[model samples]
Target: MKIILPVAGKGTRLRPHTHTRAKSLVQVAGKTVLEHIIERLKVLAADELIFITDENGQQIEAFMKRVFPDLNCSYIVQKDRLGPAHAVALADPRIAEGDDVLVVFNDTIFVTDLTRIPELCAEADGLIYSKEVEDYQRFGVNVIRNGIIVDMVEKPDTPVSRLAQVGLYYLKDANRFMQYLDQAIQAGDTVKGEFYLPAVFMRMVNDGLRFRAPEIDAWLDCGKPETLLETNRYLLEERHSCQGDLIDTVVIPPVFIADGVTVRGSIIGPYVSLATGTTVEASIVRDSIVNADCQVKDANLRFSILGNGVRLAGSPRRMNIGDDSLIEMDS
Candidate 1:
């Protein structure tokens, strides 16, 4: 099976960090979001990995080459920010007519066992991974009838079904998917002048294609700073361990500190991940993530996220700083 990862968004929600790097490259729990997704996909044994990227995707390309040097990968530049359906269509040339395709978005981190995907696809023409969500208005939901998805509603005002469609999808036939996409695009069937992937699925459903919605174990959103920190905490707690040695610092469980991290006279914990080469002295930090090469001294931080190479000193109360920033508070 071929896997297509669409990572071409500007990620406006992730601001300062996204300004410099792709959203997928944002670090959480000692690895990039893209790395987290790639690690999960490895179990599927994909034949080739296709990336649908934009102009600002150089970092993604570079990271993939550096990390998965031997993996079969291809890149397709989506020059227009048309929509998700359009983005998927860009990879049509690479996908064979009858090929089974796995499509995953890069904005959110999903944790689920995909071992049953082949079985699900064998019964239906397509498969969609869904999660039970209370806020159905904020997501595209699948309306299932008799164990099959009958319709897909994007952000329905009224409660239809709790099964919100996450970004993972599998199509049994790539050619049929492309045909539906072309019809949807030609008809100008867009919501707010942008074609959506759900629209394509809806079209397919109308044409008598069967799709199944399966539940996922975990779906973590990393679109903004707060959610990113929350996801970091969740992931760290799941695989918690102290990698580096600490001296004179109050070590708290459920924290991740990378190699070369120095902490002295500080209380770090409860949910904190410090990247490599970061030094903390005489500080108290909790529920935060400090990226690589940062120096935090004499500061009390909570619910904060410090980006790469950030420098903080002199009792800054709390911060949400970005990369390469230098801040010194008053004594």
Candidate 2:
């Protein structure tokens, strides 16, 4: 089976962080978001993998080469931010003939092994991972009838179902998917003039193509600032021990502290991750995630996240700061 990972999005929602770094390269729990996706693919024994990226493609390729040396790797540059369907269309030449293809969004991280997808594809045209969410209006909602996807409403006012597509898809016939994509583009079936992959799926459904829906275990979205922090906390909490150092602080459970870190007169988390070369002084950090080479001093931080090389001083009531920032509280 071949895996096509569309990582071409600029991740505008992430703002300054994605401005300086690739969204897929963002680290959480001592691993990049892309790494977690790749690790899950390894369990599925996915033989070939294709990544669609833009300017950051070179760096991602280099990293993949170092980590997945034995896997068949290829890259397709999405020069235009057209849409998801356009992005998947770029994989046409990279995928082999008569091969099952799985197109997974880079921002969606699945905690369970999707190895059964290959077998599932053998019995279905395509399989989409679906999960229940409280707010269906924020995502593409699906309306199914007797195991068939009858309709799709993107951020609808009133959702018919709580199931939302988690961005994991398997297509047994690449040619069929490409044909629908072309038809949708020609017909101007797009969202804000940008062709969406879901449009193609709907087209397929209209043509009597059967697409299955699979319920996933854990589907995480690390595309936003708050979601990134929450995902980091969840990943850290699952681990046994995190790597970090201490100076003179009371460390608590579910915290990850990297090497060369010094904490003094502070109580660190029930769920916190401190990166290397970070220093915390005379403060209490709880339910927060601090990236590499950061410093926190004389502040009470709770349910917050700090990016790399951040320095905090003074005594703020609460904080939610980004990377490479110097915040001095009102002393």
Instruction: Compose the digit string of candidate 2's lDDT tens values, residues 1-331.
Output: 7788988878888776676677898767666789988888887677678898999998789889998788888999999888888888888776666777788898878865576766665656888778888998888977888776788888878868888989888888876677777888789887776888888998898888887777788888888867877887778767736555566778788777777778888888877777778889999988777777888888888877677888998876556566799998787
TM-score of each: 0.97, 0.91
lDDT (Cα, tens digit) per residue for candidate 1, span 1-331: 8999999998988878887788899888888899999999999888899999998668878999999887799999999778999898888888886688999998889989888898877879989999999999999999999889998888899998889988999998988888888888899878788889988888889889999998999999999999998899889878676777587889786888898899988999888889999999999999888889999998998888888999999876567787999998887
Off by over 4 Å in 2: none
Candidate 1's TM-score:
0.97
Candidate lDDT (C-alpha), each: 0.88, 0.80
